[model samples]
Target: MLCFGFTFLYVPMVLLIVYSFNYSKIVPVWGGWSTRWYTVLFESEEVWAAITLSLKIALMNATFATMLGALAGLALVRFKSFRGRTLFGGMISAPLVMPEVITGLSLLLLFITLGQLIGWPTNRGITTITIAHITFSMAYVAVIIQSRLTGLDQSLEEAAEDLGAKPFRVLIDITLPLLAPGLLAGWLLAFTLSIDDLVIASFVSGPGANTLPMLIYSRVRLGLRPDINAMATIIIIVVAIGVCLAGWLMMRQERQRQRDMQLASGDNIKQD
Candidate 1:
């Protein structure tokens, strides 16, 4: 079953990667092996522009989403009860449940109204797209941090407070450190969502701000293109590398944390 599931998931991606190297412009014909498409991809200014725009939006969206999400999660888990807590939670979660079309339409209207009123963001573009991405991605990040907080033991935090640490200090020294893995995961998830987004971004983006997804989507809709396959392969390679790097860093941190806890335990036992 495991093998079946893996095959189901990755077989198409592998085929796409293989087809990227095909010599023919006509897809599925397989005229032979060639790297011409990759050459074309590198030389295309529009493709490079799209890649830059996508990366720029993804980075900004991930950073803002992670920050807001950590705070929201802290509130949801630590505060327990507060005025307007239910309303706040509903707003935070609304994007998660809402249809992408609806979300995109609503954001489009919002930007239009804002531009008319303030005369700022006078046109829809990267700023509007980034805002839309951040709106949805923030919810995903919050959910991640909230789940991590749910499983957390709060004794360390209480002990830190008892030992003369202020609330902010406890957060910085204990809570945030413990939440690091979740935060990193949330950031990566947010980045992926922002980069992969087509619907919401399409609604909000204007001329001169084509993201990679949008560009690829447009080409895919028209017809089969081997350059598209090459683009996907490159993205897959970059994402796979990033995931492996993150996993390794997380494991290293976890091991170090466990070792420190053991050392601290031994010291306490000796003192006692």
Candidate 2:
């Protein structure tokens, strides 16, 4: 089943890449091989602008989501009990399970309401799009952090406290380090979600705010050209690189963790 799934997933992408080099104007066809489409992609100014906009939104969303979500995770996990805890948690994470269209429409309506009432966020462009991305991104971050906190050993924190560290110091020195991987994963997830967003972005985005995915959809609607093929190929390459890099980093961290555990065990044995 896994092999079949891999084949189905990658075959189309492989074909798209192969078609990118086709020397003909029509894409997904064989007509010799050349780098013509890639060159055309580089020369397109609209594509560049769209790509830039997407990157900017992704970076901003990742930053805000990571910081705010980490705080929310701390509150939910450390506070133990509070008034309306369940309600607040549900509200924070509701976006994750909700339909994309509903989420987008709701955000757009909120923006409109706020504009009319408070006269803020005057126009829906980058600001609205960022807010929408952050709204969903925070849920992802919180989930990641919450899972990490669940698996964490409570005694490690107690050990920190016994060593004369304050509660805030324990979090900064012990908890944050242990949870770094989850936090980093959350940031990357937020960035990818922001970059690939289409439905929510389409709803919140105003004039001159089209993202790369939106631009790609508009271009593909007209027809499939070699340039579009090239653009797709570029996106595939970028995503592949990101996945490979993440895998490599995770593997390295795992190996380092194993080594640390072994060393700690050895030290205990020596003391015994």
**Per-residue lDDT of candidate 1, residues 182-235 (tens digit):** 998999999999989999999999988899999999989989899999999998
Q: Which predicted model would earn the best TM-score?
A: 2
Error of 1 at 85 (Å): 1.4
Instruction: Report, for every candidate in turn, its global Cα lDDT versus the true structure.
Output: 0.94, 0.91
lDDT of 2 by residue, 103-183 (tens): 999999999999999998898888899999999999999988888888989899999999999999999999999999889
> TM-score for all predictions?
0.89, 0.91
Model 1: pairs clashing at backbone N, Cα or C within 3 Å: none
Q: How far is candidate 2 from the true structure (C-alpha RMSD, Å)?
A: 2.2
- The TM-score obtained by model 2 is 0.91
lDDT of 1 at 28: 89
What overall lDDT, based on C-alpha atoms, would model 2 receive against the true structure?
0.91
**Per-candidate clashes, comma-separated:** 0, 0
